[model samples]
Target: MTELEYTTFGKTGLKVSKLGLGGAPLAGDFGITDEQEVQRMIHAAIDGGINFIDTAPLYGNGESERRIGQAIVDRRDRVVLATKAARSDMRYDYETTIRSVEMSLHRLQTDWIDILQIHDVESQPYELVVSETIPALEKLRQDGKIRFLGVTTRNLELLRKYMATEMFDSIQFYTRYMLLDHTAKDETIPLAKELNMGVINGSVLGMGILADAPAPFLREDIQADGLARMEQLAFLRKPGPKGLIEPAMRFSLGNPDVHVTLTGVSTLAALQTNMSYCDGNGLASEEVEKVYALFQEQPLFD
Candidate 1:
């Protein structure tokens, strides 16, 4: 196998693998999971040079975090662990935020988190995030509970609010660099670059559409559109030295602003395939430009 690449997590001063393992699949979000198999996959990811793991309480109701904790108990220092705190109710107050962090810490079985992000900041009120949530996170940092603070959002306006506060060390957002959407590239990415914040690119596979998963397997809202887009992207998957996923992974990695690109896998084979793509050289600039040109005329989705 080729060597995996590593990069500095912007402003955090921690070196992270360019490809990080996402925790959703571990919780059986993709399908029914075998506990032992999940453990093996986590170990395989770490052994394969994945130094970062991201999870959240919303994923399978904390089962993901629990499995991760068990998988990395002895190897905690080897990976940078990150989890999110979801604002569960209308009461977006400091106590609620702190309680979420506390629960996350227990579930993760870690004394201190490498990164604790506010999950889906756009769902909560901006004033509450500014007045209560961020301050509570700051308090957690000061208390030696978390090393850094981050935020994840799909809302550009919410992202702007996060940037203005200058409290976030990183930002996680969905960017289908391989697909038609360029919202992240056109908006939040530049602002994050200016603030020197790390960028974690999620939904790199367009919720599995680029991977050619059947429409029945996709989310309800995107099934129709995703299937159509998959048809358009079928040419990239023709039997070749490099398949569609390779180019998709490479495209996201090619962006200088993207510090880490996340890929969620339910099986060992899927994990290995992603690792291979990370080890290989990214797509050539001209090839990337060609692909981009083909999708350039397509409508941008939210």
Candidate 2:
């Protein structure tokens, strides 16, 4: 087991594990129907020394939180619980956000949430946050229901817009070590460090793009070309022995502002493999540089 190093979340200096287990896919992405197996994997992560575990209400519509609560029922104090609240149809106002957080606590079977994020609200109207959500989150903090408030969005613009407010302790977005892109390190990372907000990198494996090479998300009856890009990255990336995923995981963690990188991996073996990067034998500088160059060489054309 690796000795997980802790870092400051924002200026709080509240230590959190560098590698966090993303509790999204564990809900149903891998077709894990057995509760006992899911619980075992969650325990395996905890036993392996992961202090931070992140989940969301939208993940299987709250199934992820339920399973996580079950697994950590006995040792709730050991986990730094984080969850998000977001609804697409009508914007979730302050009261709804509060209700959602409380619901997540009930589902997670924990008294207090360590981190509560405004999930996916980066794309929504800004007034919704200032008018409704932030106030509610502040009230929750006052009431001792949550320890910290943050935002998770895939947009860099949204982060920039909210950065000036000092309303959030952390900002999350999709960042990875894959050859396909290094946008996080080049653009958003510097700003996050400048703002002193902990940058959490989700999709650290490009949503499992680099995790498996020979095998991929293939349908049973027919085929699709969704994997063409993945195969190209696997074939093109240089100076690394791992497939697109593992090397990328190491590369993302190499960033300084990145306090924790979320790997949405399921099962004990997969968790062990991801944690090996923090064991001090991760991707070499030369290897990461190669991937970075590839992204620089081929910026996505918008």
Q: Pick by TM-score: which candidate is best?
A: 1
User: Best-fitting candidate, measured by lDDT?
Assistant: 1
Off by over 4 Å in 1: 87-91, 214-221, 231-235, 238-243, 294-301
RMSD of each: 2.4, 3.8
- Per residue, candidate 1 scores C-alpha lDDT tens digits across 1-302 of 75888888999989999999999778987779988988999999999899999999888888999999999999999999999876454365899889888988898888999999988887788888889988898999999999999988766667777777788899998744555455566667888888989889887877666676632455565666665665666555647633567768887877778888998886888889889877637777776666666655343345
Clashing pairs in 2: 210-245
Error of 2 at 269 (Å): 1.7
**Each prediction's whole-model lDDT (CA):** 0.80, 0.73
Per-residue lDDT for 118 in model 1? 89
Question: For residues 1-302, could you state the per-residue lDDT of candidate 2 as single tens digits?
Answer: 66766677777567778888898877885556566777887888888888889998888888999999989999888888888875554477977888898899899998899888888875568898888889998998999999888887766667777877888888887633244556667667787788788778887655444554322454422122324445645543545555565566667666657888887866777778788776534567776665566546232311
* Candidate 1 global CA lDDT score: 0.80
Q: How accurate is candidate 2 locally (lDDT)?
A: 0.73
Candidate 2: C-alpha RMSD after superposition: 3.8
